[model samples]
Each structure stands twice: as structure tokens, then as C-alpha cells.
Target: MSASVRAVIFDVGETLLDDSTFWGSWADWLGVPRHTLAVLVGVVTTQGRDNAEALRLIKPGFDLVAERAARERAGHGESITDADLYPDARPTLGALRDAGFWVGIAGNQTERAGLLLRALELPVDAIATSDEWNVAKPDSRFFERLCTWSGHRADQIVYVGDHRDNDIIAAHSAGLHTAHIRRGPWGYQNADDPKLRATATWRINELTELPALLISSDTG
Candidate 1:
């Protein structure tokens, strides 16, 4: 990693949020019991596509249900204030920002997800959304936009995300330092994930583990 790493651009969905809880919140606000509501996401996400693919296919339905759920619970989108934040996300993000890093989100998400970030009160230097770009992760367009917006060169920014294909491979192709947030079943099971098997890079179990990687990335 370059010592010139002045900015850290992050992926949203699984990186900053569990995404499942967001789905669960939808069902809960709809008056479904929390446990039963889990099925709501299960039903939609179980179609065999990974979260990335499922997102593109199910986003419209996800948004419709989310609006319905929020309206049922609190009468408007403002009710997202009560949604769950992924465990440790607030702390990790806040810590990075506090550590003199330029913190921002370079993610593929529906417009509604931006609303969710505001509800959570997360601070970011910049936010890029796929709805606006029409290009999703694993495509370098998202990263390219981020560099243009942040005015940071690719070599000076680190992109952290979950999917091997979307996060690691794509960013690597763009010449940014890529880090994989190893959370999902697909990543762990797919040892041959393009990210893990890609040229030497750092992988971590969680966001808070980043500083060590920054220091040790070139130890070899």
C-alpha cells in the first residue's frame, strides 16, 4: 500500500451494514414478528444469486417493501432513524475519520440506502450511488467516479468491500489498493474467489482490523 493513502473509500451494503437487518427491519415495521420477518429477506434472497446479483434483481421490491414497512411503523421515511446499524460500523467509520483519513462511501446502492445512511447519522466525505451511475460494483466506473469526486488518485486511495469480484478485482483493475471485507458465505467458501487469488493484497475479518494491514501489507 502507498504511504500516500490519503483517502479510504468504502463499500456500503455488507461492508457498512449487515443488509439482513435492513431487510429484517422492513418485515418488523410491517407488523410481522421479527423471527417470521426473517423469511421476507430469505424468500427474496434465496434465489441462488449472490447478494450482488440479488440486489439488482430485487432492489425494486426491496424499496417498495421498505417504504411500506416504514410507513406502517412511523408514517414516513423518517422512521429509518429506528433502523439497526451494522455492528461496529459506526465505530469503525468514526474511528477512521478521526484518524485523519478522508472517509467516504464508494458503493452500489439504491437511492433509499442513502436515506438510511442519513438516518444512522454516519459521516462521510463523499457518497456515490449506483442508481445515479447505472454501473454497479465489479465495474470500475464506481471507483472512477469516486476518484474524480474526491480528487484522489487511484494509488492514493484504498477501497474496502466484501465481494471478491466487485470489491477486490474491480478496484485492483482500476489500480487502487483493494481490501476485502470477508463476511459473506460466498467469500469464505469460495477460496478461489478472484479477490483472494488475485495478486498479493490484504484481507481482513472486519473494518477495525485495517490499520494493521496498512502497516504490514509490505512486510514480506
Candidate 2:
């Protein structure tokens, strides 16, 4: 890790979790084809809209909280499990800690999602969610809370995530270094945007690349 960058914080959804099952389950609940929902997600997100708008487009005034309760009642509650983690998540996180870097997970997730992450017992030092803080990404307050929670200055943290707006641009605006990982839908779509790409301190395809990148960054 770079001496100047003392901590590495991550965004939860595409940064660590695959999130395919989350959306797939929602598609099943809505009785729509998975591909249909996937396509709509891409469309909405590409247009600078929230991914949840896809669900709203399918069903007007879709209340996520209400639907979540309905799913739980039907024994189909949303979940996050080991299977949702990308193969590189564990190894990379463990490596960062082993190398003596403070690590944390903070993102626009429900409080339930934060609890689920803690249940997994990853090697991170902290785990937080939007609901837990009463704030979400693209909102500067979210990153402000993250900086405080991590006990690191804005420049001392490298915020890694998949989304351009929420992860790269927002983190940068908050004065933290940003890593835009190229994976999930948002990852691939924004990867090609030169302006967005330039905003990131680093671009990587896998979490496994971070340690080496950060280590070598100081020398470069």
C-alpha cells in the first residue's frame, strides 16, 4: 500500500458482491423475464437514472420496502451470501489487511445488507450501509461518514466501486482517490467514458489488482 494512502474502502454491490442473484430474485418476484429486467436496468442506469427506476418502470409506484416485506412473507426475502461474492473479493481484502491497510465496506445498501456482510466475517475493519447512516452514494454525506468511520482523511482513502457517478465521480468530489473496477453492467458501460475514466485514480478489472497497483503507485 502507498504510505500516503492508509486505507482502502469499498462499495458493496458490484465492487465486491456480484449482485446477479439480487436482481434475478426481483425479476422472479415481479414475474418478468430476467433478461427483460436486466435490459431495463442497463437502460435506466445508462441514462443517469437510479437502477431502481427499472423496477418502477415495470410496476408503477413500486415500493421497495413493501415489496421486500412481501418477499419475506413468501419466504423469498432478499439475501447476500458467500455465493454473491466475486472470487477475488476474499483474497484481495485479506491481502490488503495483511499488508497493514485499513479496510472498510460502505455503500448504498440496506441495513439488512450491512448485517449480512458482517455475518460473512470478511477481513474488513468496518462495514456500513446507506440505511445505517441515513444517506446514500452520490450524496457527499455518505463519503463524509465513511471518512469518519474509517478514521482516515479523504486523501488517505481509496474508494473503489463499479459505478461512475456513485463511486468514481462522487468519491473524487469528496477528495478521495477512486478506483473504477470494470465488471458489472455499470462497470462496463462507464469504462468507455473518457471523462468518467479520467476521474478515477485507478482502473482495474479485478480486486486482485489493487494491492500491486497501490504498492507500485508510490514508486511511479
Ten consecutive residues with minimal summed lDDT in candidate 1? 51-60
Q: Per-residue CA lDDT of candidate 1, range 24-84, in tens? A: 5555555566656444334434453544343334344546545655565675442334235
For candidate 2, what is the TM-score? 0.96
Can you tell me which runs of candidate 1 are displaced by over 4 Å? 25-83, 191-195, 215-220
Tens-digit lDDT track for model 2 on 166-209? 99999999999999999998999889798787799999999999
TM-scores for all predictions: 0.72, 0.96
Span of 10 residues, lowest total lDDT, candidate 2: 211-220
For all candidates in order, the CA lDDT equals: 0.66, 0.92
